[model samples]
Target chain A: MSYRIEELLITTLAPMLEGLEHVAVGAASPIPGAAALLARHRGGGRPRVSMLASRRHASFTDGARELFDCAAQGRIDAFFLGGGQIDGSANINLVGIDGYPASRVRFPGSFGSAFMYFVVPRVILFSLEHSRRVMVPRVDFVSAPGTSPSNVYRPGGPYALVTSRCVFRFDRDRGRFALASVHPGQTLEDIREQTGFDFDVPARIEQTPAPGAQDLVLIRGPVGKDISETYPDFARRVLELDAATA
Target chain B: MTNLETLVEAIHDGASVALAPDYSGCAMAAVRALVRRGARDLRLIAVPQAGFQADMLIGAGCVGSVEAAAITLGEYGFAPRFTDAVKNGRITLRDSTCPAIHAGLQAAEKGVPFMPLRGILGSDLLTHRDDWKVIENPFSPDDAIVALPAIRPDVALFHAASADRHGNVWIGVRRELMLMAHAAHRTLVTVETVVDDDLLADEARAAGTIPALYVSAIAEVREGAWPIGLAGRYPADAAHLAEYARLARTAAGFERYLDEHVRGRASAA
Candidate 1:
């Protein structure tokens, strides 16, 4: 039941978006786009989803949360984003050169990192490229979350961290990152070996479930229309990868 | 020694402010500062803060209504409050996307009559708003035209990575702080430093960065952009921000938080 990175990202979002009344995505962010589109148009009576392009205002479905006004600042049930440089506390730095704008690296847009972190109830972080350099123990720059001086969101912060191989959540009480679950065909041993720092892993971690027929159908079917906005160019650039038929 | 109180007092009611496009360092801090001074009832001529500041203003009860920054339709996986206002028929607002609102405000701050813009058509966002005026397309008959009025606030607040006591600001990357200063009737600045007047009174720094002339009062607030980065000055306060993210779940919670953290407190630490 091992899924590729793309599959892991899209599929994880399908179920994770289950009970949300509404959600808001950030700008120049891809995973958020996929999540919003899937949640909005997934099931017949699914919940409302909103995708906020960092550049423009927000667009919603039915009565989903708005990004242009107070709704963007409203209580967002959940939030997901990739990390360029993440720390122990789950702070993100998408706009800086090694934590200082004066350094060698710079992300032109911060969009709403601080604002989103200011308002959202649940925060989920995703790092597409899981490497020691990218996924560091301490982030060089803190673009959004002021979770920790080093790493450790004050509390009830950075609910989860979704990497390609495994998923982790912050134990609010203990104030540390812990293993929440794993993707199908992945093990803590494998994920830990890949990770650079020492992390807390739950004893009874389960492999992430496989994408069911509904997930695939949703990913391939009506989901595209809802998402026609995010990848207007990319979606057209590449065709849907047909599941390999053995 | 200008704490949050003096900063807020500077912004009198019924004043004009030139709002920046994003949450710049000093402006962001000044906003919390201004809100503390009972400067509620803000009329946003443009959409700034990428919804972060917008949401803050709304939650703070500062924003009575808005005419800029269209609620990103079908964005962020949820409907926008701007849209909900239209849906539930609660809040009073007009639709204008973030950039348009910023651009219009900038054009106005510069004392320009009007400016040209794109991307609002075909969405019904700006279809029928009394604030926005639809005029004949001077360029062509085939395509009609819409004119965005200038948005000028009572007082403009700006932040810089490095600034002198006289208010010579250095905007690291974007050149928006200048626009906001020019747009507003009065401008306030909070910087990382209040350097010697000799360093601040330089004419060379006036090109991209705002000049001392445009700035009224300048305060040196270290790590002004705590939760957000201030370009070259310092990184965001990641730990503090994450705690805030957890607290920003509901308006009631945020309001309570503002009462305790922002309103209740005299200044932002």
Candidate 2:
């Protein structure tokens, strides 16, 4: 009857990956990794998952350049990006906080996020923390802008933003997020209170679907084992796969 | 001469130096040696990104600027010194995306003034960079793209699993080192061992070899990438890195770490 937030997030994201040929998961993403694996399992391995950190998932032998090159050549269909701060416009900031150049707080500088965001067709933006501190009115810096100008030759942009509180599908033409559904335990008021940015709230919000028994079985068994090498701590802690397998 | 001192001496103050990405084949031995030698105010370039070497250099106040994609300790968590220095505005942070860094070096590798890159048009990374230009494709004329100037560092430094007497280094799958070597003005390498025979003579090993012509100097330093592993040669010293992460939280703690592990010791290993 009950499911973990990770499982819920995975299930929420799985549909976005419906017919994607190749999905690439970036650094520090255990949930997205699980979701990608789950999507693959559900698709009978249709959408190939390439995790930058995983030996099992990554097919590239050349190095980081190859990953970038692959994305450039339009090989990667879906990708995941996270940020220190993500805003209403779908702009994600992975750079430091407070200001430009000099900031009071600093995160690891933007890795391949900017380049990947522009190329990957289905860019699912997810952050585990959804407080106002994170979901600001505007990020101090934009590591990857959610949308691009019409003449910019852009092929990919933000599809949706999945947070701990709710799911907001990004309307590219409007350049704003529309609240689609709230997680089961969370309320619209909770999302409103926690989120710093403004969004278009639908007349009725749907409940984010909970993972079924079969989803949990796949998550706990094969998917958990697949991501273990890349995310040993996450697999052990979240899924409790270590004890289950042991 | 292919000695440790010579390799360190080649990297002068304010020199734009490029290094390989973390966990591949980090030249930790050279990094420690540079610290021990009091190399200062160097503009460090992490080819795509960096970790221990960049953090340690920043903590030592040896770095003047950092141009990279990201600088984190991966599974180990935040890179403290780099984070602290950036917050304090101690170092000039030229934040970049991963492919851009690679593309920039690639331009240098081809001896080009600049290279065209797809993506980054809408990203703030483009807005902040004066050096990066947005232009219509000359041939296509209809397509808009971003062009990055060449990032030709003054020196390229990395460690490898092995090198022969002839000075060819075997890097296997870590081709970024080769890119760094080709892009920079000079290449410095430290290897785990010096083989008796030439690496290029063996067809299998030769494909992975960066020829001696590209290598300015080579030093055989055992466990060169100590805290960071040398690919297949050894595993990372996790306890030592954990100790580093623990101690490098503050300036004083970092200095204490430097004294014990860096300056006080005869060598890092």
Q: What is the per-residue lDDT of model 1 for residues B1-269, given as tens digits with 9 covering 90 to 100?
A: 36545765787664544454433443566667766665666665443533344445555656655554322211221123333333333445544445555556657767887765432332223443556665666866644445677766667765676665555666643555666666677777777776555443455654446676777777677766555566556755556554554455455666666777677655453
TM-score of 2: 0.96
Per-residue CA lDDT of model 2 for A203-235, tens digit only, reads 978998888998888888888888777787799
- Tell me how many residue pairs clash in candidate 1: 62
User: Retained native contacts per candidate, as fractions?
Assistant: 0.01, 0.88
RMSD of 1: 19.6
Q: Write the per-residue lDDT of candidate 1 for residues A142-208, one digit (tens) a residue.
A: 5555343322212224677788777777665565677777887777777776776567876677777
Error of 2 at B76 (Å): 2.7
For model 2 chain B, give the 10-residue run with minimal summed lDDT. B260-269
DockQ of 1: 0.03
**Clashes per model (N, Cα, C within 3 A):** 62, 0
Best of the candidates, DockQ: 2
**What lDDT score is found at residue B177 in candidate 1?**
65
Q: What TM-score fits each model?
A: 0.50, 0.96
